[model samples]
Target: MRGLKDKVAIITGGIGDLGYATAKRLFEEGCKVALFDLKQSDAGLAKAIDALYIQVDISNEEAVKLACERVENELGPAQVLVNTAATFIFKGVDATEEDWQKINSVNIVGTSFVTRYTVPQMIKKGGGSIINFSSVSGFVGQRNFATYNATKFAIRGLTKCWAYDLAEHGIRVNTLCPGYIYTSAFVNSCKVLNLDIEEENKRASEMHLLNRQGQPEEVAAAAAFLASDDSSFITGSDLLVDGGYLAK
Candidate 1:
């Protein structure tokens, strides 16, 4: 919680449930927040928190570069960067090259690009925190989830390497690995799959030791800790906000 006030923070995929929740928490903590996403958000959502919202495809390197620059110009050089932008594509060995390309472009490459540009600003500020979102999927196998799982695993790997690379400049890089969280995306996916919502919810809840899916705010709290000086001693580590799912 310390070292957050008036700090510039960027949350990629900011319009989404998790990202938006994190942004709101950071804003409440007195940080200047910026939301970057491919989709346009309700103006009121950003206005409600007095945060900047930019619609940009993180997968596009040039676009990401410009967007980071805009954040610097508008919100000041970001002292915190949360790479929450991701694309989900579930498939096993049957996954095609196109599926790999689509998911990898956004999940792996886009996350790297955003961090690439943001690191300089952080270095300029003499230090920063970078929270890369991984998942329980990153640490274990899942049925027909090779495409998505692979990228999640890669995020953990990247965070460790970046932690080492950035340490000299006082930057900390760590992975936030959360279990299934009850989000709008979960609801939408259930609708698309034509699954019974309550049944699916029950199924997901059973997967966690806590007997329920995690909430966006819960994950946001973990992220806030990582973004704040409270986690100053942690870096190159995977903080499991997984509701003991991995333990079970």
Candidate 2:
């Protein structure tokens, strides 16, 4: 996309399937990329792509602040920030305090910390885009998804508020709400549970009007658009890369 060349972009959950895919796309568009994750990457994936990888626990404000500083010093100020790191804790009304803490720490507070630190870098660069990963669950309820869904919903709310607060600084904030995407984690979970992979996939496929899971690259494409000047006028919006899941 236009205006992405030589820009710096940071993606959280960088080693994950979707996050890595987005990093690759942005790199191909000529952007310097940084991957921030809680876990260390064993494969040297970021090095392979010539991107910077930082192990960071975004829930800790100080760690996030330092990490952002390092990125600025290394890759220059970030012009695009994608907050894809999240903790999935599925629970219902019976959720315990511990469950709430675990989910909120990473999904909500952690996201906030990263954004709080990165916004200044963006402002220094004159403008930027922030993509917060929400989910279809954020819009609709599902069984035993109260804890996770609550945080996702909060993400959308946060995006809108940030958009309003950052507009004057030329920052754009939006939520990326995706449906079930066929990812390595899905296949691995099926194996761990001894579930038939094809059968489980079929069950998930039925949830979307497309009759199949979305791909990581497809979502990455939308992310690139939001990060680029292509989405210059878009902000405080939910870009549904859900394959018509909510249309049904």
lDDT top scorer: 1
State model 2's lDDT: 0.95
**Residues 45-102, model 1: lDDT tens digits:** 9998899998999999999999999999988999999999999899999999999999
**TM, every model:** 0.99, 0.98
Question: Model 2 clash pairs?
Answer: none
Task: TM-score for candidate 2, please give it.
Answer: 0.98
- Please, what are the lDDT tens digits per residue for candidate 2 over residues 1-248? 89999999999999988899999999999999999999889667988779899999988889999999999999899989999999888899999999999899999999999999889999998999999999999999999999999999999999999999999999999999999999999999999899999999999999999999999999999999999999999999999999899999
lDDT (C-alpha) at residue 6 in model 1: 97
lDDT score of residue 164 within candidate 1: 94
Highest-TM-score candidate:
1
> What is the C-alpha local distance difference test score of each model?
0.96, 0.95
- 90: Cα error in model 1, Å: 0.4
Task: For model 1, name the residue pairs that clash.
Answer: none
Mark the regions of model 1 whose C-alpha exceeds 4 Å error after superposition. none
**Cα deviation in Å at residue 42, candidate 1?**
1.0
Which 10-residue window in model 2 sums to the lowest lDDT? 42-51
